[model samples]
Target: MNRTLIPLAMALILCLLAATAPAADSHPGWFGVIADPGALTIRNGVAGRLSEYTVAIGDPVRPGQIVARIDPEQAAAQLAQMQAQIDAAEAELEGKKATTNSLQERLERILTRPDALSSGALAEMRGNLRTARAETRAAEARLAQQIQERELTRGKIAKTELRSPIQGHVVEYLANVGADLSTDAAVVRLRSAQPLVLRFAFDPRDAAAPSVGTRIRVQEDRSIGAPGNDTRSHTATVESLAMIVDEDSG
Candidate 1:
């Protein structure tokens, strides 16, 4: 009787301790990370060595902002070369036109003194004037070609810069300064700041969960994101819910 009584007393005490132990309170709704409208991946259309970066992760960005750039040195050199060619061509054209005008004036002056030279000499002067004019025209055509080439070089230079497509914070960086990248390579990722959305799930049995139009506060996960950012929450109303649960998780 004593042994049985002693065992029963110990069992009761253990059961009471277990019952008294506190458990964490469970929230009815599941937690989810806040999402932005969407993320924008900054990329470049040309392949080259990354020259510099204007922003990094957690840095604020705006649409059309110059985020990163590849080495445009080659393109720039080509542009300068093209520009110089255009200038030279233009100068050549001007010089040729001046020569043509001078030749025309001389020919007119020679014609005015018809008795000074024979028909054969006058014909030679007119031929010289025509040749000068032809040369001027050739120079003009050369100048036009150089100008077109310069524009093509300008376009190539533009492709070296990788710009942000959305106003947001920099989220990821796939390439850094001095890194080589292929065409259409991703450089930086930007996320939109305005119009944030929250995605969450709820257990069907958890008393009453949030529904459409239900107001709630979104608490920032201070442990996960940018440091020194405000952990305060913003109020929002639920707009929609998923009708089905994920079978693998459920």
Candidate 2:
């Protein structure tokens, strides 16, 4: 009975030691800085001398807002030339129309007395009538072409002004006033401010568990002894996960 009791006591002591043994230590997940999840680019939409600049770096701008204006003197001069051409064509067209109307009236009068009209006189009037009609048609075509040219000139003039394409803050200014800019030249950079997002990379193993829209916490500063540094924690949604792990970091 004593031997059996000794074996039972030994087994109990072994169980206590196993239960008290410390668990293995694990490393906490390393984190990276968070930032907005979009890119910005500065571009010019028109070609002309940059006459005015209304924005600078770090200035906030709204979509469809005008950021700068180009020198409109050249464009205005072209528009004026087109307008003059249109006016001249219209005046010529009016004269041709009047001439055609007078010729038609004369033809009507002669047709009423066709029997009394001399062959030479009637033939001359008919020839003049044909010429007037032809002139009128030519004038009509010229007027149409001039009108189109005028409109095109006005459109080009409007293009001299530069407007913002998105609601964002100006991150950079690439051009200055008095600079001659060509079409598609870089002018200013825009970065979206609303619905801002933060992005950071994580271990592929941990990233697997987070799918799209998964809630996560983002820390601004990660320094030792900074207990209140995490107060600015932002809740972010997972946008995407890389399929390939970075070899160097892994």
Candidate 3:
């Protein structure tokens, strides 16, 4: 019985030694993290068929750069129609003004030579002059209304252009050329190029997790197991921390 107990006691000692031993070549404070800029979806402000698609996945974009265009032909045509109406209205207004002036001249002539016309004829001439002036005012109002509509059509044409809101690379095309899009519809997705952020997960119980404003140095792990590979390093500051604990990690 003594000999059998000795072997079991030796086995327990070996297990303890293994559990306490430090892992080989492990570096302290080393953790894996990912670096990337977040994505943004670009949307259209007006509804129309896409006439131009000027970007694809992985294409670099600049702020205010035109990435797509909705077809402006409809708006342009509407504007043309409005302009024609305005022109016709202007011509009609001019004609009415000419008639009003001619009637005013005839009334003045009769007033200066009162005996040249009878009282009934004079009264009728005054009534005709008033009617002509009213018609002229109505024509002027119609012209003003047409001009306002033309300006509105011009505004619609301006909204057909779709531009990138930031400096980034395109990640996706939500709508393709010739596709009909509605107002506020997403046209493409982009990943921002500036201010790259580093993200990593850690145990919730860890007291050493970096807080906001803490500076950190990140080293690439590409050199691991490679004889002559050079490791890259980047410096960053912690800007935020997740408020909710990750259930799987925690």
Highest TM-score, which number? Answer: 2
Q: What tens digits encode model 1's per-residue C-alpha lDDT throughout 40-96?
A: 777778778998988878998877888888999878888888888888888889999
lDDT of 2 by residue, 1-250 (tens): 1211110000011112222333323435335544444336656655788888788777888877877788888879988888888889889999999999998997898799878689998899899989999999999998898888888778877777777777787777778889998888887667775444444544444433446655544444555576654334444556555454344541
Model 1 alpha-carbon drift over 4 Å, by segment: 1-37, 194-211, 214-250
Error of 1 at 214 (Å): 5.3
Ranking by TM-score: 2, 3, 1
Model 2 residue 197 lDDT score: 44
In the predicted model 3, the residue pairs found to clash are none
Lowest summed lDDT across 10 adjacent residues in model 3 is found at: 4-13
| Weakest 10 consecutive residues of candidate 1 by summed lDDT | 4-13
Candidate 2 all-Cα RMSD: 16.3
- Name the candidate, 1 or 2, with the larger lDDT value: 1
As a whole number from 0 to 100, the lDDT of residue 115 in candidate 2 is: 86
**Between candidates 1 and 2, the TM-score winner:** 2
Per-residue lDDT tens digits of candidate 3, residues 121-161?
A: 99999999999999999999999999998988888888897
What is the C-alpha local distance difference test score of candidate 3?
Answer: 0.73
